[model samples]
Target: MERWKKRNWGWKFADHLSELYVVALLLGVAGASFAAALPLASRWYPPQYQGLAMGIAGAGNSGTVLTTLFANRIAQHYGDWHIVFGLALIPVLVTFILFSILAKDSLNQPAPQKFIHYMNVLKQRDAWLFCIFYSVTFGGFVGMSSYLTIFFNAQYGLDPVRAADFTTICVIAGSFFRPVGGWLADKFGGIRMLIMLYSVVAIMMALLSSLPSLTIATSLLFVAMMSLGMGNGSVFQLVPQRFQKEIGVVTGIVGAAGGLGGYFLPKILGNIKLATGSFTFGFLILSGIAILCMLLITIVQRQWRRTWIGASGKARAEHV
Candidate 1:
């Protein structure tokens, strides 16, 4: 690592473009990873046994806050983080130098991708089908992460630190549940898992809203997070299976939709709590959305099965 940077340290100005893309991907991974965990780090916690559990979860999610707050000052003195950053730059800087130092931009015209091809992909109803269903899971994971701390503090009557701790528990369950969700989907079909998880989430949220006890509410919301995380994995798995030909475009579009849903869930919760002095209505609305997603996925799954079955029947007839 030290030897490589020393060898390529004198990179020129034309080298910045390729290196910049590496830096951008670095920032994307950092932002997405941190966004996945931030709100959990900012909430409050319960007492005794609950506190201990929340503390462990909070510590994992709190990496983002810890890095943001302390890494700079520590690095300013010790320089460990910078050493890693310098190491990351080695490939980016070297590649740009080797390519640009000798090669010219080719004169041959590059073929353009057709807008109609992307439009044709967009027109496929199955594409929108996954978008709707996955939005619940993706939205729930990202949204709940954003509002989990605030929602717990407000709904469950914990102070900021305690709320953060409970939210951390939710975050922990959701993050870990992602892998478990994928495993479950693999064993049982993804569509089946999505239906199961979304149903559980809707039911849990409704139950959470009505619970007067903080302990009960916290427990139910934790369950909701688990379901939401599983639903996210299920939705993506379904997306790839259903839209195998256009997985990349469908993934990007559906992923963005899910993120958009996450962005809105918190704001709506805040408004509902403020306007009505109750979270029951808010929970009920989200439950409705989840139910709708479940229904949509179920319908899509049926249609897909029928289409495949019909095609197989025609093939068998031809053979006979």
Candidate 2:
């Protein structure tokens, strides 16, 4: 009887959501796990350390690799991307087997309250700011991660090997620095961290705008990339603090914006490179965006001060 009931329940659960969540879960794990591990495995020496630069710039690029390698390979072998989906099902099958026995969601009930309060977050202007900030931060990380190597090859005249080497170095610096950026945001102030990081990015990008000698350009690029990566984490850290109760809405909107930013940033840079026979405009455009970010933060700073005052005024009046 127990076994029969279990089969019926499992069938219901699977029938409801089917494979969409499973595929997303697998893709997320595979992409993030590989990006984290790939840099750790590769060997880096001085000339070879250039790969590290490429890696740093393009660490998020592991997703493309996973898809191109596994998905494409499966497609070629079996004549469809659908085959890869089936291949992904194996892990889901195994997970289901384990979870069916070992794990269970608590059915505990909570007293109902005003569900309408959840909608209050929609009124917060900072939510829009957080979304924009994340768009630039995470967007820059993933965008540069995929394109940095190609950029180096185009801008610095490095061969494929050297381009990839620099990417590795750059991505390593950015990938790990992200979490640190968020920590600074938590301990210091998120807005303050954003101001500082955006300023750093602006200054560095300004210096980079000229597309100077390769040595200066490469060095400046590295610094700018580092700032962008940190900004990515800092923005996200602030997002949760500001939208604690509306996690799904905040995360979804911000994450989507970041993805869109990533999608377009490279194309913009690549187009600039293609049109002018150099990456000068690309550098200049990024620098300009950095400046815009700085300006936006300045505006937000005033709003933040007003908010603190209003909150404090309310508290004091209540005490009286």
Candidate 3:
């Protein structure tokens, strides 16, 4: 009996390790796609349309909504989470085939920068600024997407299915608004739009810290997500305009920062909940960060307008 138990434990441990390895590979591919796609989007579109184009491509993150909505249900139906992973490959394969057949490089590809030129992007202040901005916007969007279902279940006593439903609603809002945010940024200014959106995020997150009624909390999350999504679009709108020559490297850096931020936000929330018996401090800390981002953008915009983006923060047509 003891020998049988030891063998069972070994099998379970091996299964867990295999799962971790596969998840790591999946994330690696996803990260590379994100980093590579933005640069292509920027190059394919003109400066004036950069925000809209990138926003549309970035909106692909809405795929998370489908997973959040269905993964648990699918797993439960099959009585196996592994089956869910297997099913996910269908869309991935379809996307790969479609992209291979349809995708095209820009006609006027920029000359490849040297390794030193790519490294020099890290020395630029603007690159770091973009990283921080995306850390809050894209970071918050992804972090919340991962955590909201758990939040709903713990705080509101919702069933797993219902919690996932609520999370799906919020993810949909964020995903849908991304393109709208870019279009608005193009018409107004990325800086101006981000300032307003960050302010909204601060306010909504602050309200969430109070642990309001379920309806109100979900509404606020939906609104906050919209702002975060738009903020993502707004940030990228400015990226290509400022670092046209180094978009690939800059996007990779900024995208990594966003991923790190996403990773940490959930850790912060989970740790805060464990320590405080609530997520209030976590929400408050996020709110404070949003406010800080708002102020930083405000202070920086004066100089940004004076330099690259001009008075409106719009990319000048001549730059294209």
- Model 3 lDDT per residue over 15-106, tens place: 46765676666666676789888888789888889899999989999998998999989878877776776777789889999989988878
lDDT against true structure, model 2 = 0.59
Q: What is the lDDT of residue 123 in candidate 2?
A: 76
- Per-residue lDDT of candidate 2, residues 107-152 (tens digit): 3212334656655665778777776887777787678767877877
What is candidate 1's local distance difference test score?
A: 0.59
Q: List model 1 lDDT by residue over 1-320, tens digit each.
A: 87446443422212356765766565555444322222222122111121122223323332333333343444455644544455445655785597568644323212435666655777878777766775677677767776866776776677655666666777667766765665565555576777788889889977776745877877887789888766665554444344434444555677657767877888998898899998888889998888888787666666765653112111112211
The C-alpha stretches of model 3 lying farther than 4 A from their native spots are 1-14, 17-22
C-alpha RMSD for every candidate: 13.8, 12.4, 3.3
TM-score ranking, high to low: 3, 1, 2
Say which prediction, candidate 2 or candidate 3, comes out ahead on TM-score. Answer: 3
Prediction-by-prediction clash tally: 11, 29, 0
Superposed model 2: Cα runs more than 4 Å off: 1-124, 308-320
Identify the superior model by lDDT, candidate 1 or candidate 3.
Answer: 3
Candidates ranked, most accurate by lDDT first: 3, 2, 1
